[model samples]
Target: MILETGVVVAVESDGLWVETIQKSACEVCVAEKGCGQKFLSKLAGKTVSIRVLRNKRSSEEFTVGQSVTIGIPEDIIVMASLLVYLLPIFTAIGGAWLFSDSDWQAVGGAFGGLLLGGLLVNLHSVRKRDDVRFNPVLMEEQIQPNILNFQH
Candidate 1:
């Protein structure tokens, strides 16, 4: 995951609004010290507002203008929870039933099954998202082009 720094622009009940700095890639091809794109970005500001998840330990490091590194996508939290809790619990029950001889043996079987399932699931998820990793995207502005320019 790409860890990014942004400024807190707004605070919502469940999340936070952050204006992240997006460096212009135009700099890569620019010949001069500064290009028109850079100038425009600077003029318009190199920031994009993005909504981020909030938690109880809400770090006070971020202020309206202060910079902070917030995690993007935020789905890892959910995925981890599923793997940690649901996977284990489900595996335990299933494993116990599959290898049921006594109560203690069933309990041990359940834990073992959960371990295998959790590991396999996590590995699969990691491989799946390897190319398209999770990241926060900014809201796009809608623009209408001049459609009157038609050649007959």
Candidate 2:
């Protein structure tokens, strides 16, 4: 599980609205210095919020303006990216090589494989869109006041 912190901006009977704080490392990477991402993050000022899963345990209760930390599975992100972008191209190349006959059959196989791969990738992504996990946690001593203004 990967842990990330956010501030609770709103409270509901079932869950809370946690505004995720965007960190500088997201844009400071040397490889992304000149990319469109840097410009976009700058324009947005680094915070986004959506409802989080309700805690089943009573100890996890959260109130408005409270700070919380959520645990998200890292594997989900990795698998999703791979499925969407790599699967199609890989299937196309592999199918083409395996079915090659110096004729149009090779072309047909390659196109079919690529199409199937892309379709599967998109379907998987949509199915797992709600898999993000959230939990409420107390802020550490020094950072409570700053979570709301840490945006850059």
Candidate 3:
């Protein structure tokens, strides 16, 4: 499980809307001074809202401003990345191979295959939209320090 900490921004019947900072390792890397990733992160301000499925044990207990941890499975991330990135390349090669007789035909076939691969991926994502395996879920709440503890 990959876990991230976030603050609950809203409570809904089905889940909590959590807001987390969008951070990347590039921000803390020694080479950040010249990294294109750092520049892109700066261009994209660092906050994202995520809809997390409420924990079954505490589904109705969440409140806005509460700190919580959310988790997503590692396999889901890996599979999604593979489907989005490699599927097109593999399909394009297959397509070009199918039209190996002519260079122009191979090029056209490759483009068509890339498009078809992307479309298939999109369709698969839509079909799996509600699959629990791909959804992030609330894991645990963080305990906040009591402000009154410092009072005399």
Question: Cα lDDT of all candidates, in order?
Answer: 0.60, 0.64, 0.77
Candidate rank order under lDDT: 3, 2, 1
Worst 10 residues of 2 by lDDT: 134-143
Question: For residues 61-92, what per-residue lDDT tens digits would candidate 2 score against the true structure?
Answer: 55567677765556754765677789999999
1-72 in candidate 3: lDDT tens per residue? 877777878887767788887564565689877767767757886777988876564655666777777887
In model 3, the Cα lDDT at residue 43 comes to 84
Query: Model 3, poorest ten-residue lDDT window?
Result: 142-151
Top-lDDT structure, candidate number: 3
Cα deviation of 82, candidate 1, in Å: 2.2
Which pairs clash inside model 1?
A: 92-110
Backbone clash tally for model 2?
0
- In model 2, pairs of residues that clash are none
